[model samples]
Target chain A: TQLLEQSPQFLSIQEGENLTVYCNSSSVFSSLQWYRQEPGEGPVLLVTVVTGGEVKKLKRLTFQFGDARKDSSLHITAAQPGDTGLYLCAGTQTGANNLFFGTGTRLTVIP
Target chain B: DAGITQSPRHKVTETGTPVTLRCHQTENHRYMYWYRQDPGHGLRLIHYSYGVKDTDKGEVSDGYSVSRSKTEDFLLTLESATSSQTSVYFCAISELDNTEAFFGQGTRLTVV
Candidate 1:
């Protein structure tokens, strides 16, 4: 079973549209991260959220960690074509040696 | 860009052959990981190393083995290549546990 699940599995929207992607799990994580992967390349870290109920903003992108630390969300406002890519959420559990990644959400922003 | 390099960016091998992918990093990170990406499965860890000469298996470690004899290099080996093992493999490194990880470009392996 996937330790983390993300939805929607695939998304398509026009330029200037707004969308939200979610990552949910039954297990609580000590830290959570979001990554973006372009074609033919590996994933790159976008942001890291460690505290529960913490919200961070990166320009047009907003990330929030759930109050219980079991979920998180990524929201993009006025999305552009540059936002098209596979978005992945990863989490690290307390005392765990490895990080777990979620089933990715592939987003396509059309111009 | 994170001082990580993966060799043999693309390879095609026959079934039953052995294949090894290499990950080298200059960051001197304490943690190194190997993961495979497939359709519907996202990225699943195969193995990881915490320190030189110390390694551990991840959830999908059945057909793969890893070694970390040196702090800067991690290797993933396939005992016997199978069509099912064809996928893009990635290498990641982090300075510490539960921290931000930087990933290598990837190695695309195809078993025919």
Candidate 2:
């Protein structure tokens, strides 16, 4: 069983549309992070949320950490073709050495 | 991107053959990790090394082994390759000061 579950395994939308992806878990985490992976490339870190109820924005991307630290969400505004890629959410448990990653959500934006 | 390199960027090996993938880092970070990415699975950790001669398993450790003999290099070996093992593998390094990790380009392995 996956410790973290991400919804909308795949998404296809037109450019300029908005979309949101979610990651949920039953266990609380000390820190959570989001990453984007493109074809033929390794995943790159997008943002990290450490505190519960924290919100971070990177240009057109917005990330939110749940108050209980058990869930998180990513919202994209006016999505563009360049934003298409696999989105992954990972969480690090307290006193743990490895981060648990969620099944990714593949997004495709057509211009 | 941090100075991390994965060898054999692309490989095609037969099943039951032994394959070793190497990860070299110039950052000399204390932590090194191996992860595989698949269609449904985003990125599952196979193994990680904390320091020289120190290693541990991750969520997906079966059918794989890792060794860290030096501070700058980590090796992942598959004793017997399987078709299911065909995937893109990534190497990452992390420092003690922060949780942010730097990932290598990746190695695409195919088992026939």
Candidate 3:
């Protein structure tokens, strides 16, 4: 079984603050995806990192995949109240098409 | 949006009763999955279907059963509802690989 572990289960910070979330796993993955879910709604796709050591940015959000393909990170710069949501990382194993999701990180940005 | 819809958005049933949830997709995707989400636990797969009449068990598939007779519909049934089965259920659809999966709004079930 593949297990993904996310750090900082809950985070609260004032607006304009910078925060980072980490997702680590013991097994290597072919691809990693990040999702943000609001209260009472399903998760929505944010980004996908396929290559090891790859970095992708979406406006104020930056995502990075580890060189070993076993870890990933999401960094938000100058966070705003709209950035508050539950962040989840899912990893697809080398040969499987299913994804194993991390525990998730609930972030709250206060204005 | 992925054009995915789940029926019975919220339901309350007693133990030992049979309940079925429906998932309908218009995306024409070949893969469909059923997942359960609980507090502190992100999401656990209950069952998945690769194609019509082709279904497989997922990580957590003990008390759940699924059927897919058409490409646009999938049904998940609970033989006998239990208190522990009370959770938010989500249906997802994907094409070919695991690139980007589209999820439904989810159905919240309560077993008393």
- What fraction of correct interface contacts does each candidate retain? 0.82, 0.65, 0.62
Q: Which ten residues in a row have the lowest lDDT in candidate 3 chain A?
A: A94-103
Error of 3 at A39 (Å): 1.2
Expressed as tens digits, the lDDT of each residue in B15-107 for candidate 2 is: 999999999999989999999988777788999988999999888899999999999999999999999999999999999623887889999
Which candidate gets the maximum lDDT versus the true structure?
Answer: 1
Q: What is the C-alpha lDDT of each candidate?
A: 0.95, 0.93, 0.93
Candidate 2 deviation (Cα RMSD)? 1.3
- Show the colliding residue pairs in model 1: none
Decide which is better by TM-score, 1 or 2. 1
Q: State how far residue B41 of model 2 sits from its true place (Å).
A: 2.0
**Top-DockQ structure, candidate number:** 1
Off by over 4 Å in 1: none
Candidate 1 Cα deviation (angstroms), residue B15: 1.1
Put down candidate 2 lDDT per residue, A1-111, tens digits, no spaces: 788999899999999999999999999999899999888888799999999999999999999999999999999999999999999999998778887889989999999
| List of chain A TM-scores, every candidate | 0.99, 0.98, 0.97
lDDT at residue A19 of model 3 (Cα atoms)? 99
Residue pairs in collision within model 3: none
List the candidate numbers ranked by DockQ, top first.
Answer: 1, 3, 2
